[model samples]
Target: MKAWFKSGAPWVWLNGGAVALCMIMVVGLLGLIAVRGFGHFWPADLVQMSVLDRDGDRQEVLGELVRKEVIPARVARTNGYTVAEDVPLVTRYLIKQGNRDLGSDFQWYLDVGMGEWHYPENAIVVERREWGNFYGFPVALKEHGEVISRLGDEDFWPEVEARVERSVDLHNEIRRKEKVEIGSINHKLERLRLERRRLELQGVSPEEMAQAEEQFAVEREALNEEYRRIKAERDAIYEQIERDSFDVETVNGMEKTIHLHNIVRVTRSNHLGVFGKLAHYMDRFWEFLTEEPREANTEGGIFPAIFGTVTMVIVMSIMVTPLGVLAAIYLREYARQGTVLKLIRISVYNLAGVPSIVYGVFGLGFFVYFLGGSIDELFFPASLPAPTFGTPGLFWASLTLALLTLPVVIVSTEEGLARIPSTIRQGSLALGATKSETLWKVVVPLATPGMMTGLILAIARAAGEVAPLMLVGVVKLAPSLPIDGNYPYIHLDQKIMHLGFHIYDVGFQSPNVEAARPLVYATALTLVLLIIILNLTAIKIRNTLREKYRSASD
Candidate 1:
């Protein structure tokens, strides 16, 4: 043992064990998140049971069994629950009885209060737009407020499915017309309005101002006509969609009529086979990735958040790479090795260690309030009260993140530059190459891989950062994406959605804790995947560059 300690074998083993433990922890954490998040989409069997209520009356309860936990009888009693002295442990169940519009969607029941429970084949799970979900039994299907088919009829389900499919199609068409076509027209009208205002502010000649106003009026009139046409079409679709309704009887014996237009999907969870459930899971997972969120972001897809995160990271990378490379070159190649240089290096290193929230504060004060306000004053004076760029937005967010990650790039590039031997420079100079040419063509090329490594690190940090983003560009819900079919295409002045902020909002800020819990896990997993993809892309580029430069150096 003493010989092993002297030979440093013990230290090596300790280090290996530490690394293995870290890997195991990371994998375990990811596995847990994946299981919890992905399992949310799977169709679980619905249960129907009779339970004794607080008043000792038996009530019918219908819902999906979400979770079960065992609690000490003492703890249960402390929480005002009745527990037998002989019962040392009590089992409790969390039931998802989603009908938020009517009442609480989730409820807990003690095992002692529950009677026989069984899966009901006729029980249906209705996914809706406003409320979380509806659990009931189908009574009848109606069209134009008249009963068209009764639930006992063999053709009832087929007719309901057909009408529901039609409703979904009409809803999608209405959304496209309203959000895409009419939205684009409105965007153009707004731009024209801004342009006319800009012309007035610029003190253009009266003739030019009149021409601009005339053009704006023509465009505005055309857009309004288009909007009216689309509205009429949407109204027609809505009329068709609202013609169909279904009556469902709840567990408490209350019958309610739900319009087909309001329903997103209906599942017979208890009746589904393995393959059917798998298909349902895949469909739901796809929707979660592609659709816009609803119900306080507790339901629906995170496509906008994904797009914003990628765009911001790309923009930040573009801004940081050049600036960091140039600064590193000036510091390492041209600047005198003096006290000022040493101080600058120290400052850069210290900046990296500062709390990220401090960077957010600096970004808000300097970028949004100071620099952005100045730009608004100078360039966008016409959009005055609105304060165009004088608010937190994508551009300012990207720039802020660029500043936050700049030190890493500079340090990495400088180290790479320092690694190139003095003889390489001497040889280049001997071959009659100018200092600038040698630095750019030879030194920078060799340093590209290191610069990319720094970028990978920067992207990983920036992509997962929520604190700075929340203060800069991220919003709980953005009305529209930053990029669209507008003339400029990409709107840098718009706030964006981010997965990190989405996770934060769903996990902490949402009102429905049970509904938001799985979403938190899903969004967190997605953010991790996104960071991995970005880092992998950067690593690929670095590897290619490193290989190219290695051959050159040889």
Candidate 2:
């Protein structure tokens, strides 16, 4: 063993073991997240259970059994639960009885208190827009408050499904008219108003100003008429959607009337086979990726967050690459190798080590309050009091992230420049190539792979960062995406949603912790996947560059 240690075998083994252990831990963590997160979408069996409480009162409970665990008898007893003297461990279950509007959705029951438990074929799980979930047995179907048909426990599902589908379609149409059609009209009207104000500020002639005002009034009148027409159509659709309603008997023997418009999906969880459940899982997973979030971001999809994250990263990359590359070239090629150069290098390295939150504060103070405020004051005085550019937004957020990752790019690029053989420059000079031409044409080309590597690292860091974004542009929810159909297309002044911030909000700030827990894992997994994809794309480019340059360098 001593000889092996002296031979460096022990250190080699230690290193290999450490790498293997890290791989195991990472795989395990990802596995846990995937199982817990993705499994939430699967159509678990709805169970009807009879329970005898500690007070000896009996009641029927209906829900999906979410988790089961064994607890120490001592701990169970300490929690005021009675445990059998012979039993050293007590089993308990967590039931997701989702109906936030009714009462507590999550409940725990000791196995001792649980009586007969079985999957009832008629039990239904209703996913709603406002409430978390509703689990009960269908009783009847009504049309406009009138009972059209009474249903036996198992007979109502098919009708319920059909009506729910119609309601969902109508709901989507209503949303489109309200959010897209009316929204576009509203945006255009606001822009016209802003334009008129801008023309007035530019000191237009009285005749031009009158013409502009006349145009604005005409446009506004047209837009208002269109809005009224759409509003009337939307109201008609809403009335149609609200016509159907269903009655369900709760586990506690209370009947509640729920409108079909309010229900997003109704699943007969107890009756679904494995393949049926798998299909349901796929459908839900797709929706989670594509739909806008509702219920304080605890329910629905994270498309907005995903879009914002990718957009910000792209913007940050665009801002950082040119600046970082230019700075690196100046420092490594042009600047004299003196005390100033050394101090600049030291500063770059130190900047990389500064706590990220400090960068956020600096960015807020400098980029938003100072630079942005100045831009607003100088150029957008017409939009005064509203503060167009004088706010945390996509532009400032991207710029701040660029600054934060600038050091990585500079260091990587400088090192790449240093690695080229000095003989290459000498040969280029001898061949009558100017110093500038040689540097740009030969040295930069060969260093492309290294620059890409820096970019990959920068993206990996910037995409996952939340602290700086919170101060700069990220919000719990954004009303509109930064990119839209508005003038200039891309609105840099708009705040954006971010996956990192979404995770933070859903996991920590959500009011419904249990409902949001699975979302946190799902969002986290998505972020990890996104980073991996970006890094892979960069790596592919780097590989291509490396292949192209290998022969030239040799």
* Top model number, TM-score: 1
* TM-score attained by model 1: 0.96
Give the per-residue lDDT digits (tens) of candidate 1, residues 334-453: 999999999999999998898888889999999999999999999888788888789999998999899999999999888888988888888999999999999988888988887888
TM-score of each: 0.96, 0.95
Off by over 4 Å in 2: 1-6, 72-89, 152-155, 551-554
Which ranges of candidate 1 are over 4 A from the true structure?
A: 74-82, 205-208, 552-554
**Per-residue lDDT tens digits of candidate 2, residues 295-324?**
999999999999999999999999999999
CA lDDT of 398 in candidate 2? 94
